[model samples]
Target: MSLLDASMNAIHLGFAGLWVGSVVFLTVAVLPLARDGAFDAAPLETVTSRLQWISRISALALFASGGHLAGTRYTVDSLTGSAPGYLVLTMLALWFLLALLVELGSKRLVGGFADRKVRQPAREARPYFLAASLVGVLLFLDAGLLSVPTAIPF
Candidate 1:
């Protein structure tokens, strides 16, 4: 790989890790606390805001780096015709789903926070976050599969 390709791959992986980690953290940690009324509205709001920012920034970074890597590494025919290409497409789909789920969950939390309702918002947002977490995990697994060499040539 060229240095530029390697750098883009690193950036892509880093942002993917960040995005997935943040979603998992929110789902596993923050949501439960918020649901239990452990956090006040202001703190919940701040947390949600930060989560949204992370999601948005990560989305953009992943898209840019992923696009570059894809463009350099695969042609339209290769992308459509190979197992690794399908995995890439799957990752792309998972990325979109993750982004959508996070956005929906954040909106729910923000809306509830606006009304000074922390627990309710957390409750409402829980399903979306849970789904996002699952998608994130799947995305990582797909990436790992893509990275491994097949015993038989494709």
Candidate 2:
């Protein structure tokens, strides 16, 4: 790989790490505290708002660098016709789903809090948090697979 490719890979991984790390932290740490009323909603809402911005930027980075990496490494045939291709395709779809979930979910949650000045019920927030965690897990697994030099048949 060229220096540019290496740089792009680094950027892509960095963004993925940030996005996944934040989601994991929110799901594993913050959400439970908020659910139990141990944490205040106002501050969490502010943090989520800022996190949404990071999510957006990282999503863009993922898209750009992932596209570059895919283009350089695989043709349409190989990308579609192989095991690694299928995994990559799944990862791409999950990435988009994650972006939508994080962006839209944060907006809805924050907006609800803003309008009512109250914390969202744990039951309501559970589904969103679970979805995010699932997406993060799958994305991380796919990334791990891709990182294996011998995993791709090419």
Candidate 3:
């Protein structure tokens, strides 16, 4: 790979790792800490706020870097230049999926945090976050794998 490709890889990998790390922390540590009742409402709010901040930043980084990378590959007829093209496309699709879910779910979470009546069950948040994160990780992995330049005949 050229210098540009290497830098792009680093950007993509860094954002991917950050995004996954944020989700794992929130799901494994933050939520349990909040729900175990070890902390008061103020503390729980503090924890989720931090998690959300990290998540938003990481997501934006991933989105921005990913969009830049995708933009480089964009053609008049298509969105990807990577081979195993279907997989690459699927990977990009997950970014969109995560954006939508975070928009919807986070809004709901915020609404719930603001008012208990709309709050989804505490247990649900971890799973939802994990699912979204998992999707992201899969896409990241696929991009790393398929970005190689070898072309194999079927």
Winning model by TM-score = 1
Ranking by TM-score: 1, 2, 3
Give lDDT: candidate 3, residue 53.
72
lDDT of 1: 0.90
lDDT of 1 at 34: 92
Candidate 2 local lDDT, residue 14: 93
**Clashes, model 2:** 0
Residue 86 lDDT (model 3): 58
Report the poorest 10 consecutive residues by lDDT, candidate 3.
115-124
* Top candidate by lDDT: 1
**Candidate 3 backbone collisions, by pair:** none
Q: Write the per-residue lDDT of candidate 2 for residues 1-154, one digit (tens) a residue.
A: 8999999999999999999898878778877777676756677777687779878999899999999999999999988998788888999999989987787667656765745432564336657767987998999888777778476555
1 versus 3: better TM-score goes to: 1
Q: Which sections of candidate 2 miss by over 4 Å?
A: 115-118, 149-154
TM-scores, all models, native as reference: 0.95, 0.88, 0.68
**Candidate 1 similarity to native, TM-score:** 0.95
TM-score winner between 1 and 2, please give it.
1
Query: What tens digits encode model 1's per-residue C-alpha lDDT throughout 1-154?
Result: 9999999999999989988999999999999999999998998888888988999999999999999998998999888998888888888889999999999999999997667899999999999999999999899888878888473145
